[model samples]
Target chain A: MAENTAYDRVKAARANNRPTGKDYINALVDNFLELHGDRRFGDDPAIVGGVGWLGGVAVTVIAIEKGRGAKDRLTRNFGAPNPEGYRKALRLMKQAEKFRRPVVCFVDTSGAYCGIEAEERGQGQAIAENLMEMMTLRTPIISVLVGEGGSGGALALAVADEVWMLENSIYSVISPEGCASILWKDSGKAADAAQSLKLTAQDALDMGIIERVLPEKEMGKEGFYSVLRAELCAKIEELEILPLPELTEMRYRRFRALGAQQLAGE
Target chain B: MPFIDFFNFQPKNELEKGGRQSAPIAQDDNEPAKTCPNCHRQIPLSQLWGNDHCCTNCDYHFRMNSRQRVSFMTDSGSFTELYAGLCADDFLRFPGYPKKLETTRNASRETEAVICGTAKIDGRECCLFVMEPYFMMGSMGVAVGEKITRIFEYAAENSLPVVGCTVSGGARMQEGMLSLMQMAKVSGAVKRHSDAGLLYITLITDPTTGGVTASFAMEGDIILAEPGATIGFAGARVIEQTTRKKLPQGFQTSEFLLSHGFVDAIVPRAQQRKTIGSLLKLHSGGAENG
Candidate 1:
């Protein structure tokens, strides 16, 4: 018999396949509202963002949600967004700043889909616009890695004041399997890669790369939900106190300090 | 008595004597530091280095190191290195990795595999980052990403054009996802720089592959490649194995990529400096030619 990991076994036991993160956000964050497309073009399903209340403090929430089944996956573009997805997020982010609401983002995706349609639609331009908006946005923003956070698609929403990662979630430029295949010339090196990737939440937090790591013990998916809600709530409470200018300045400083640690002795 | 004495008066040992004495004339440095491999003759390395590390003899192209490239491409000595202290640590206790890193460090005299700085090209000031393959294969580790992103931010702050010469084997496996995260980090930086209406040029040199290729390597206002360089995401072997067929010759080469529209152009190394300088000037609308 194959040895099973706690993460895989738990995911299997839950059988909880929500179609999109939008579904979970509707069920979880209070007073949720959905925003429409970029004014320039049409709406993109890969990225969805709007204003919502997380523990009574209003926050702008944007997430990259992958569909569960075939139909939904096709609709969601497997969470690989086009240029419009990023543009939509940027629109919401700018609106969030105008309203002085804190922003929260959930990242879950493989990467931005690189199909001909997306490229022609200016996927690169879209992501670039979002990064520019987020860096200059005048509000506290927090990003949660609820699942796989891949490359520019994830980073589009991931530039934030604080980044929280779930115990089983992974964040990377590319997947560990992809890394192994590229480096070792063999896909089978994936297992060896997991150890080397340091993609797990604990490893990321230990490196001071991320702010916090939400834990998981006896509880399964519900536990994940609760931890996420609590963390968002607590962080929201703490961040709500700062004035808009201070929050924006702090956010900029936070990103500036990222990756500043010395690597020689570490 | 011997077969050697049949045709010649002098012994074969005379040739060995010439080889042994005079410290070998330092192996003919008079050849101007470069030669055509096919013709076995001097090719004017200085002129070629000023050009872009190409051999003038037969135009046999060569990859330029990041520093040589920056000097050749940038205006005068305008470069100011940014984020110079960032580097990678050997986290996994990787076999021979420490030794390889040490050797590369001493050889290249750089803290990391990549270098980021600000410089002027064709009278247009731009922030530039060049990844040096000589150092740990120009692997994207934490420091590489940090330097790249910081330079991007610097570009955005200064509202300057950005030129990135991307050449890397891939993410550094020893550093793991930290190395991989650079893809996001640098891509984010590139995105920000581009969104600000700043011109960003991504130039791919020989062997640009893996995550680097997928990310910023392809993300540029104007994409360019060096002639004969292999530029692709999946290596030739993987694609060949997947298709169960031999890849056509030069499948991932710059010529192929350019022909396929994946690359904007395939530039001879000797013309890269002039080409990039001209492009920056054209896009930024600075002084036409410096």
Candidate 2:
């Protein structure tokens, strides 16, 4: 049976057994050291950021974590980040740039947390600062979409040299239910909205929104982590070799060209 | 059978010597009397327009189209529009997008949600972009992003100061991830403009939230907001639903932002030109003296 509908993939991405950000971090990174607090505010459990060794190469790792089970997910705010989470990620990213270490990010969230406290703490400004700084971070950076890559929240960590997505993952400006309700005034039409969103990893790759679609055949097994680890190491090493100007310039150009079809033809 | 009157076009009370402000009787829709949402006073449209689209009664600021904003913000006959008439495609062929664009184009008379160009404000030249509220609430789709990015790049190359006004419902969802990419793209442009040592000022208008806020709107060197404008990282309704707490009065208003130190100043519509002009004069690098 062919099981390749967009809605199917969306559900699969949110499956209970799917590996979360911590799973990837625990598997791929060695000598992991956890860092906390955004310096300006309290620490957010939704985002985990610190230095770690990836194939013996020191790098700063940040992941938006959706903890497994009810209690854990509640503790992590279901992986939706607060302003402090993004700030913490930015702090680590800046530190990574200073030490000439590569920055790796694992993004999986429904979106940034929408709350009175988040708004009061300046979620927009926090994300905006990350976007501006990450654009020219002066270091090799890679972002992998392990699950849902929700709008600006995910994007705060994803203005990278290369953004990759797992096969069943989805990245969208808004969730299908939200989009359906807003556009058609019918949340029941989410499947149709999902089809229209072009949110699948393959769609993202086709649109040049992302660089790669990581296959999910052996996803939860030991072989999956080893393969991903090898690929990440090789890719980051290649990216690290580029001169700083070229590296940042390339990163800028990558995002600059996404919706910029007008420039080429004109 | 009694004859029935089908149409009723009469006011509640016939004409008489009116109250304190019988200043001008509006005859029809063209010269209609608009009621202020704040003061609940009936004021003529012309009087409101004359007062910079703010309520003459309670000073409630009304939303202005890009052209009206540009006309008032710039010197007379100084704006030269750039990146005009760029086509917007239903790139992903999202449901109803093509038809929505068609209706929106017909209604708003703007090809895009933003109008960008170079303008002279108070005798000082700068690159300017004003978001048009009539079009999709000035949503930043591909075209809006392209125009904004071009303006910033142009300003950087010309060594011109940039002034922009932003109002949006965030990234346009019809365009999907492509719409979201604009945030990063425009921020890159802003970064380059900042790196060039030129000033970029953003005048945030009513309801500047979502993707716009998280990107170029907040990236301005000097950020200003209109009085009574709602400025926030998240939508108030969304926050209320998420937090399930009663939001405090004046929670995300311009005054709140000013108090919170997120905004540099809460400039009223009447004082915006003078304040911006003074800032520009200060940052003009002795050009005025020369």
Candidate 3:
């Protein structure tokens, strides 16, 4: 195999054949019970979140599902959540806090859906509410970037005690094509945009934007699941030991210190 | 008076630029003559500024740059800028981004898109952050985010109220993820300010869309919008394309938002100072002078 460039990894991350959030839940969680509806509005299929057991500890599992087929993709809005989806995710998170269950979110989305209805329903407000609410949630949270973590949509679920990413996953503020179109007036320069964006998991880890990078090199599905499960279990155990106040403070401080390091380097 | 046909609206030319390209405000010749896009009436630039950038003929709200907005809102000679020293570097080293930033700096006469400071709004001291739409559509980048965070932090420390005037296209694409991160960074600061029980107000002007709308702009305790302002997360064209449906008449405008309960009030530019002062006074339990 040739060495993969950033753009190549982006393609790999977006590969339809690659395992999705539902696959991870099936492999990692025990007896997961899927929940739906935001209670304020109807259900949003783009975000799948519910209760499950992670290593004998009941936890809230929320993940963006791109869906399996063309029909499913339409149903899931190609993993781009509407305002209701975010609201649903937040509802589950609040419930998790009430039960003191740890939250484990899998982020994979092109972005929050940018449509007329979505905007009318307060897409920005939904994401904003989550960011503000997640900051002070008493329960611990661990977010994994499973695939395309694009913009505010991904960040809505990613403010956590630990944010991990799959090796090939792409996390960016805007998609390469979008950036290319905006910056160069051409979407064909996506490869160049990818390089400039520094959106690979390795770049994210190096920038202190993410906590860990899970390697998926040459691993079969079973092997990948085992590694992910083990790592997640370890992180959960480590986090569960800390007091709630300390964990919350740590989460707040982690985000607050983000751009300061880069600024210091300059 | 012409019947206000909301459905037959022509999208503001300023918003059509989408913050990527500089609008007509970039002209360096200091041309005194200007035309209102809404009414298509010729007016002197001085008249526009004097009217808080509203068209004299049709009362069309024109986008105000950061300096103009600050000067218009704050008490005379009371603004002490907080983070003027902070500037955006070519963090990603994207091609031509440095040159673009330099050009924008010279053109806008500002280091960054946002001007954050401590100012007196009708004799009430508050921490303020105003976005300059002239500077790359007032896109939120690292510096804009940091400045906003600093303002919130300062407001929290001093127990002062916060008044942010938002006008932006979205996050800066040149800075890539760095620009997007401002949403979270500024949102965190707003959270901290809210937790501190300090009053935080947001005034959406002309156009406030994208990541800025998704973050601090929507998190205000009292959300205010200029009449006729466009406030939404996605651009109108993007929404139209994605939904494959025509948007409703006056969609995303301040009047629409007010009816939908998204905005607390739709303030006309002339009455904004008095309205904001009254809100501050009410919050602070100051004696009502009216």
Segments of candidate 3 deviating more than 4 angstroms: A218-220, A264-266, B1-31, B287-290
The pairs that clash in candidate 2 are none
Name model 2 segments beyond 4 Å from true.
Answer: A1-3, A262-266, B1-30, B287-290
Docking class of 2: medium
Which docking class does model 3 fall in? acceptable
Over the stretch B131-180, how does candidate 2's per-residue lDDT look in tens digits?
98899998889888888999999999999999999999899998898999
Candidate 3 lDDT over B1-290, as tens digits, reads 25786656666776663754765555445667678888898878877877888898999998778887888998999999887878768877888988998899898898888999999989888999999998988888888888899899999999999999999998887777767777877887888889988899999987899898899889999999998998998889878877889899999999987887788998999999999988888888666773
Estimate the lDDT of model 2: 0.91
> CA shift at A239, candidate 3, in angstroms?
1.6
TM-score of each predicted structure versus truth: 0.71, 0.93, 0.92
lDDT of 1 by residue, B247-278 (tens): 66666778877776667887776577778878
In Å, residue B44's CA in model 2 sits off its true spot by 0.7
Interface RMSD of 1: 5.1
Give each model's whole-structure lDDT. Answer: 0.71, 0.91, 0.87
Ranking by TM-score: 2, 3, 1
DockQ (CA atoms), all models? 0.23, 0.53, 0.41
Please give the lDDT score at residue B210 for candidate 1: 64
